[model samples]
Target: MIESTAPLLSVRDLTVAFDTQNGTRQVLHGISFDVMAGETVAIVGESGSGKSTAATSIIKLLAGTGRITGGSITLDGEELTHLSEREMERVRGRAIGYVPQDPMSNLNPVWSIGFQVEEAVRANGLAQGRAAVRARAIEVLQQAGLADAAKRLRQFPHQFSGGMRQRALIGIGLAADPRLLIADEPTSALDVTVQRVILDHMASLTRDRGTSMLLITHDLGLAAERAERLIVMQNGSIVESGPSKEILQNPQHPYTKRLVAAAPSVASQRIQAVVEDRGVETLEDLAAIPPTVRVAGLTKDYRIRQGGFRSEMFRAVDDVSFEIPRGKTLALVGESGSGKSTVAKMVLKLEDPTSGTIEIDGMDVSGFSRAQSFGLRRRMQPVFQDPYGSLDPLRNLENTIAEPLEIHGVGDRASRRERVRELLDQVSLPQDLATRYPSELSGGQRQRVAIARALALKPDIVVLDEAVSALDVLVQAQILKLLADLQTELGLTYLFITHDLAVVRVSSDLVCVMERGRIVEQGTVDETFANPKQEYTSRLLEAIPGASIPLGGL
Candidate 1:
């Protein structure tokens, strides 16, 4: 049971604000909470809800714009809000560990994984011998369930996969044996299989070590699966606080009710099929004429070396074939290094297939020249998974949204601006936000801008690559509904590439399960989900947390 005595971490009237041009914006508005020893507490919120700011304030790592406006933060009964920078550095890695949402950005690109992990340990005054540090690093990595932990120590950040990178970050966080671990959206980027594995490992590790955790996430199901207690934040204040089971089963606040309801849980989808009937059984008999996009005998190979300079060809995607119908979505689901993104790249003409034929609108793009490729691009648009990266940081929203129209010379200046307004309205973004840059927008707003940009050319098909995965559950539902409406309005086809089966059920009309560079299962959304043939597909379905839990009655 969680201790009712003095908590491991305590916050009283905690407030933070950012000095923006719009004026000082209060983020965390006098929020209060206590995290008990050996307990998992989740700070659940939507975009701009101050979840991340609260976590950073504990470690004195709130970015430049944000400052602690009021109240106090106590770690093990010691005040942290007034700690000096130098003193806070000593407390950072030792007293409180932080795992940000994006490991790729947090981790140094140039440094070796082992060196970074060792450096973190050294920062905590654990300056042992290099051998001892390396041994401890490997032990932590193993504890995090990273495969071939010792051998992977020599690997660069790029060499490790997405899930592995997250694991590596966790290892680094635990290197100093911190009393408190703050994981900010830990499972946002992982697939169902890998996400469940990592989360389970983290729960077990924290419980065994008696470490307190403050998990910040938008995923309600994730909170139910991992957190013992839940704190729901909206705007900037705590809307509700209770045990996880209580919050999940009997959400009191309206925001919490909406959040729980908007979760497109796989279990809920499992019990009730999205489609009334199983229309298509095989790719061959999907539609009348042909598939919207078809790939047959596709292959891609990369060279990798072993101990010496001797190299071997690695087949990332080997003879893969699939079909997607018009005005429908086909989600290619898989974990990292499962050749999902590689296939997306090949489809987008970003990478050339070593041996294969890609048919779009029954036209083979295999040997397309620059002119031909440009034509194909005009008919197809891509909505990237990461909206921030997809857009230009320097350019304002108008320019970003108008880029495709400018490239294609589709309209004049005023016409393009008018088109941009229409697209923005479709995505339910404010027209005033058009002048803002990508950096100025929140994650949801940025994603909506990306969607507006994708729809600028009014392409026949749009590739939504994990488009809604990064969003809050409410925002995700909004985006999903927007996609569905657009599909109906424009008769647009979508290739929704995501590892999230929740997204698959919500956005996809058909499903294609991928594993280790191969398509394990392919059928209509109703057919495959209702009766998953592949064990991998079944496992993916099963890994979805809180799948069996119903939404609290609103």
Candidate 2:
């Protein structure tokens, strides 16, 4: 793992600027860094910290009037700042491979996985004929840790799972035998276990190929674990830079310290503690007091066709049971395709359970009529993971939040609009945002807007499915705090679904660990996290980025 003395990629006094409607705003303020031959370097910080801006500027791919206003970028002793569009294209794939953050956005949905890889291979002149290019595509996918590469050659991006799509993207990036690879938050959207697997495979692949990597991410802990060297950025400048272990052990900068502390690893104890006189006193008292939401023996099966009319039954959720007391939070945790989301869907009425009984405030929903189902929906609401996607793009914030009230015939236009204002205030969003659209707001702002919309109906139970997983540490912290505050103020029950164990430890009262299609473990978050009975649960905790780093000082 020792890198040579000579630097493979050297960036000096680099500055980046974007032209907004107001004026040109400079983002990266004369930053400098280097990547040694066969070395992995990570630039870590929160969103808008210039990690991605700097990475994009290197290849002259800055979006919407953004440009490298100052400094030099030299790769393999070649000055890249002066390269033309055509020349840069030649360097992009063959010399410098790039794996972007979102695989769905990066990969074309219309094309098969193999077609994209073959295109990259053929474009680089790696192979002449289509047959040869296809063989190279399979080999590239195998290198990216995708099993059954040949059989999945015809699969579209939508047909593949999240991990599979990421592997396909990696395959396309590394197809041309590039000397350097730049992965920008490549596995940020994946679950912790899947993230670990992808990163391990990527590390092994790069090491074996002797390809240097410039990893861009918002996760300081993940950067510390994945990279040999770390460069911390804040407000468009490098606050600290050094060996990963050294900086991780003792973060010197205030922002870096904030990141370390805000990381779910060293976070708050619990979202909201139960009072001695109120809420469930103990687990045994659960039967004495009626739970707000109860799910029992939930099972869901989907029939999937295997080429011909031959279809097989696939059980998504199987015999899972849990309960959330009034105003308490229960976290559903598992890897991808682990039935956590399916369970959430069943509770939310998005999916029908093959066999189960779901009770809301002691009212069983199995035989509910149309009017009862409508009433049930009004009592329950969901805050989805993708805030922007969940909200209507065409509607303004006020309309979006008021839509639920309108559909349920809650109030008049004036009252609904006033309620919208109140909900926004409750979520800490400004009133002026009512007129704005989803595209105009930041990720955090959109999430707040989503929360405001979810609370419009004044539902008793809220289903948060991977709510804060996509946000940065700071924004995520703010969202978690907001949820906690809302829960206390509104007496709302939550069925939180996520893959982040650290967040589960702090945000929920109870934790239910699912694997494949079954609930493997369920208990109090503190007890379960402190002493995980299942090895799968233990492995998940260990898979957390930089879990080995001691955070006692932080």
Candidate 3:
């Protein structure tokens, strides 16, 4: 359905700037690109690289003092740069659709899902009556991969899971059947399997409707696999632009090379680079090490209240057992709602297992008294997924890290202050950042602070629950390298829980694949990835966004 001759969308010499307290500051400079009818284009870069700024500029949705300083934006040869607010409103949903990055922030919590989609349909004049709008809403939701859309139309955003909410947003974006769809990091936070379903649905729907797509993301693997042409952006400039395969195989820019090397999906093939960089022992050499934490017959269940006086027992974790060898890593891999986090909570003693035995260095913790539990806390700690949520916004970096040591009564105020600086150094954070609050730091820096806080007590066992899942590829690589180096230097153990299989390959010695409430497969990382025994495990590997595309291959 694509027309190879003419461009559906075109932008030339686009320059954007913002009026800051320090005066005018330009963010994007001389950016130009074209998207042919039904073709997909992707803009890739790290945070603050002006990728999202460009996308937002196309829709004239920039916040605050942002304005287009210079450039021309045209759609179907219609100039849009100088359009009035009122005129742009008519062109928004009717000619161009936008799927924002975060569904929780974009979707209204007070409204039902059906109302939102219906509103878009009515606003674009795609449907005449309320009944027609409702019918169209259901159709779009179903096309977006939400099963039983009609039955769940009345549900609020909070009632749906993260994946379901994302699908709902996609449904609303496509409700008007716009000519162009701009998806901004649509699958960044989703599990690989859920991401695959959403992406596949978008591909089929867009192709069927002849909708040209412009994807904005930091993930090079995803962009390489999905986009027909790739635009590599750095410091608000286009360093490289070419066919995705050609750019991957022969990157002309230094930034592009760094991006490819840092990406986890492709880096799995060059994992030895990580080991060499950290000088850590291979998994085979670490096999004889005794486990720092051991679990046997772990099970967790919850009672869900049904109708009056009735409840149903739900098994959140069923007979889940794994071991983290001293100075080694054990990764739990699964999709969302697969009991990986439940198992982590049980191990960290944050949740009580219905029936199981947890032994930390041969000390049974199932029957620990209050005093004994407090003692256990000093030896094991947790680093959660959302650093923003985990860190205390009111507390500065020093106090956040020092709080743990103070809780355990480890040292005096003076000694604790020195320890905070040392912990910052250990996590590769600048010492000057100790006085900055969480809000002042970037996402990667906040996560480093969280890691420093977890290590304040010198815990032998650290449980990282999706710790690197939210990070950019380069930041994730740095964090993983730091973890590996710390493991080698301090001999610490890690219980790594994540839905990202690409990460498990390079960072973990052992892999456990969980599904429903049980582990469907467990083995060494090499064995499991090389020959997955379970169908679910194989499916998960296949679901990785760019799994089929070889690194640096045409």
Candidate 4:
């Protein structure tokens, strides 16, 4: 436990607001907290809970319309609220480091990784001259767990994978070794294993340097395991705050209890137990049933330039095969570039396979004509990972959902409008939200909208490519439950693609573990999770965050 002496950072009665077109709206009210030197504190909550807003407020990095309405932020007994913008700029990299939630948004795509890191190093006066800055940049990136930092420095943001980009952002944040580090959903976009690696590195680095960390995340299990102290926020206010273990074991607040109960890591254990005890049917049972979708030795290849005039064929999906029975889900689990999405694309006919046949409901889609492929789209639709990107910013909910129906010529304007309303209701969204734009909805709501749009054409096979990855645990549970209910009612087949093992445990009836473009292990969810045959599969299972903690005990 951290000694309650003069704290490293303190906040009291913090209130924040944003200037909307309708006028000023208070987002946070009278929130207070403290971070002791060398202590790790986590703020856990769902979207719109003001966790990120509070952290951003401390650094004065709030968006243009946002401002601290009432607050006192003190660091090292120095008042920070009254600091000028220029003074705050100096204090930012030197005194406080910030790692934003989305690396793509925070990182400049046009700049090289080395250039960004050096800019921070030079701006904070941590290093002088071109050679020193470059050396320091490599040192910091290597310290942040990036391999071959010196060589990778010249690469652009697009050239790096999601985990690599996040590591680069962390490198930039810790370049100057600030006294305090504010990490906002730093590992939310990564695979479970990659998330663990980055988080463990951050934890060790901060402890070694005696730098305090304010981790903002929506995963309660992660907070419980990693943070000594936990602050629970809901609807823009703190609902509870105390020792993380204490709060997890005996949550006093109802909201905190709900959050713990909805945590995917904890819920996954319960699912595993239920399936283990009840004994689910084997993969042979699935084989007996006629498959709605089947891929026989599916493979995809891309031509890549090797030299001046030489090219080589790169196999993206190598001999991957799986089957999904009618109304059942077959999850393709792997890290980034592990061919999960590529297999999904092939299954959906978005990408043509180099070899093997894809049969949907006994029809060979590989030989599908242009018109036939167009018709096949109505029976198979895709719900992508990023809801915001999948949704059209200019289109409202009604129009977005109705577009699919219009494209398929399923109905007239009036009928499509009615179908849109039904889809909204089916997904448990408000009727009034039909008029709202994509930006107006929360992450969960936008995902629900995406699901509604995918179901607009009454597709038989809905390919969900990391559909619930970006949502909070509570919202994720709701969406999964909604998907299960819809599957039961509509008899929909799902080709779910995700890197989250916990999600695979809960949502998938069968699991296909992919590694480097090949399915290493495939079986019923119970069989595969209980006794993984491949070392890679075992590593993936072990990498699930908070897996060491017992859900039943909590």
Candidate 5:
């Protein structure tokens, strides 16, 4: 189905470098590829492997120290590499569209979705009249698989869910109908179901529109399914490229082979082993303690606005009930829109439930006073998804981690510093890193800092919302091990909200499967994973991508 005439985008002997004090460090070394019209070409590589650098270089968005030192880039026979800033700006949105990696960071939080999309449309000279622009925005939002697009456009970024934000970003990308679309990890932040839906929408849209696509992702399976050609990059070099199926099945390069093998599927890795080491506390340990937190008949309903003041009550968490014991982990697993995070937010008192009895340590926390809530907060801490975003960008590591101690008046200056140091050691961060800001640290290091910050208060329970999902496999394993070690040392409890079943199997004593605001299944990790009773649970288990491959091979 690929149209292989004159290429839509072409790059020859591309080279990019960053000027560090040590010298010019080559990031992308002599890479060349052609993307034809209506064809999808995927670029796959590990983190820091120059995959994103390549994309950024193409758009001339590379950092101050980085530049494309050599190579020619052409789109529709017009050279793009040597364009002026103003000229490039004119060509960017009109000739080449872009969907960034994280929609949340890319979008304006204060603006309504409509204004953002409309601005994109106006910038590209797509529509003249305001009404026409709004109409086009709604149409594009619907094309991106968002329901009630016109009504949803009025909602702010925070009001919309993470997946919805991704859809909004995609809608903005398609507003101008650019000749080529450059999507950089568009679905990485989304849950599996939402990811599938978005990918299907993108594939369908580009095919129908005859728009060429350049997909940059770490997910090989996604590339295999969507792209016509595959270009593998590693250590700032192009290692291989050819037909997608051929490369996937018979990769010539070791890196490509590893990438292909890492594609997780249902038949790949079996859910057999415990996440924790043997001789650790099991289900019996949970049975020993009375419930630490209990929710019975939990429900939340939002008044959704339709047309001209018309409203309808939408239930997000519908009669969900569960219990968590002290010194154990209770994992809530589901794809996006499955209401797992809604339950966590309610538990954290970020959102008030419409109806439910939520008891913490045999007492109801649903209606706690300010003082009582402060006490509850001291008992329940949170570790969010993005460590870099959560931590203070302006504050140094010591202040950021020790701020909790200062807030609660736990210890004086000397004692707090000592505690901060101890916590840093506990999380395996170097002592020297205490002076650095969050921006200076790598993704994994930032996450470690977040973990240290979460543990600073010595909270009895920690709500980890997709805490380790963003990390690489090796770093993820380290963090998982650290969590287990912490549980043993501190006897801490965790409310782990994640879509990763592997994390559930390894870290949780109990697993709760959520679907559309309801608890579809709940049991011991072994029982539920090994013998999932409900069809939804079975499907979740089945949806564990590339599970059949051996970990060593991957």
Candidate 6:
């Protein structure tokens, strides 16, 4: 792909710092790299590793207290560091297009998609007159792979799916046909299939346009697949830089190695229940206990009004049935609005199933009285998707874990304190973190505390609804491993819900694919993934980033 030794963009001795109440905290530690012409390069690392910080520094759009303390950023031999705000503005969309991380937040809610596209096009002076601008907007969206571009132009961001919103952003980014495109975690929030579609279209457009891309992500699998060269950042410093193949197959840095290891593989880290005999917790009796949780013909319906005083029924979950074995994980895998979460709510007894039976340990929960319902709560607990939203910010780690115990009146003050300590230990958190609030801990720590809270009552079953979806790649791996270890020791059954099929491979023993409020396929992970019976399941597996990359041998 390299046509010449000359580079398109270059940075030298780049350093970034943020001014806070505490003091100046340097982020990028004199990092330097080059993006050659027509080349797709990637910088990858976990949160706080400064991968995003470095990317933002190039455009001088660092948020809040972030500022470039020292660096030499240039484009086509033109120095960008000394440019004024006006000059930088002119260089931004016309010369360097940017696709930000969060589409929902970045896009304006009140404005239509066409309005946003027109704004970008008009701002760059790409086309004249309202008619010309409308035509150009449609053309860009069509290029971004959105069908019926003219009809959907009036649609708002809320009306668009995650994939569509991302494509809209891509259309806006490529509106002016900038020489270089900076894509920051473009598909992080999308479904696997949707992500594959967006990536494929973006790759095709960039290649056809001969545009260089600076792809930023926390996923090595995606970076390996989309980018030719790799720059691994850690703690604000560059750890390794080389070809993507060299970086993945023979990473030298420990952090890079961990990232590579964290990359989800089709045939790796098999999903199995690790039943460790701790003497106190015996798995021998679990076999005799009928499936910890069972469901038959589960369905949920809602009402939507058409016009006047008339409304029709909308089925959210349609005849979804599955069984979760003792101490094993069964993941409900699907994209957004696939009824996976609705099924979870039904299982939790939060909603009444219209026509189905949900049995816990061979006992139907349909006619459970108030007291039985309370006891059922003790037997089953839930770990939600967003740990930050789920956890109480005002509460300390100690109290957060022990809050469940306090609510159920399981133990006295002294016992609860000791139990909190034990839970911290179980989750591999420090003893001193008992005094720290959620804000003081990292995302991974907060999630661990949530797990500890879920396990406080020693629940027989735990329902995780998109639990690991919000975490980075490496942190997600660590959490998965932690869940496996806890399952082995505590012998706790798990109901894992996620949109990521790749995640399902390493985390669940059995897998069920959901699409449009129905179960399309269900089987063991190995059998189903090896040969998916349904088209939806096949697309999901095929959509996994780097699915074509041969990483198993490594």
Query: What value of lDDT does candidate 2 attain over all alpha carbons?
Result: 0.88
Q: Note the clash tally of each candidate.
A: 0, 0, 0, 0, 12, 0
Question: lDDT tens string, model 2, 151-173?
Answer: 88898999999988998888888
Off by over 4 Å in 1: 1-4, 21-23, 267-290, 305-309
Pairs clashing within candidate 4:
none
lDDT of 1 by residue, 425-536 (tens): 8988989988989998888788889988988888898988888877878888888888887887788888888988877886777887888898888887877888999998
Candidate 2 lands at a TM-score of 0.95
Decreasing TM-score order of the candidates: 3, 4, 2, 6, 1, 5
**lDDT (C-alpha, whole model) for all candidates:** 0.85, 0.88, 0.88, 0.89, 0.83, 0.88
How close to the true structure is residue 188 of candidate 6, measured as C-alpha lDDT? 92
Q: Cα lDDT for residue 442, model 5?
A: 81
Query: TM-scores of all models?
Result: 0.92, 0.95, 0.96, 0.95, 0.81, 0.93
Question: Quick one: how many clashes does candidate 3 have?
Answer: 0
Task: Estimate candidate 3's alpha-carbon lDDT, on a 0 to 1 scale.
Answer: 0.88
For candidate 5, report its TM-score. Answer: 0.81
Best by lDDT: 4
State the number of backbone clashes in model 2.
0
Candidate RMSDs in order: 3.1, 2.4, 2.3, 2.6, 4.5, 3.4
In model 2, how large is the Cα lDDT of residue 127?
A: 92
Instruction: Output the TM-score of candidate 6.
Output: 0.93
Specify the highest-TM-score model's number. Answer: 3
lDDT per residue, candidate 5, 1-554, as tens digits?
96458999999999999999999888888999999988899998877888888888878889689999999999999999989999998888788888999887899988999899988888888888989988878887998889999899898999888888988888888767788999999987776666767887888888888899999987766677778898998999999999877787788888776765544443333222235445434567667788888889999999999889899999999999988998778999998778889999999988999999899889998888888888788888999998967998999999999998888889899999999999999998989999999989988889889889889999888999999878754456577778888887888888999987756777788999999989999988877877899998887765553333233334
Residue 128 in candidate 2, Cα distance off native in Å: 2.1
lDDT of 3 by residue, 1-554 (tens): 85358688999999999999999999999999998899999999888889999998988999899999999999999999989998898888888999999999999999998888888878888888878888988998998888899988999999898899999988888877889999999999999889988888888989999999999988887898899999999989999999987887788788898888787872384243234554434556555777788898999999999879999999999998877778778999999999999999988888889998999988879888889988888888999999999999999999999999999899999999999999999999999999999999989999999999999999888999999999988889899888887887788888999999999987888889999889999888877888889999999998887777766521
In candidate 1, how many Å is residue 108 off?
Answer: 1.7
Model 4 residue runs over 4 Å out of place are 1-4, 266-279, 552-554
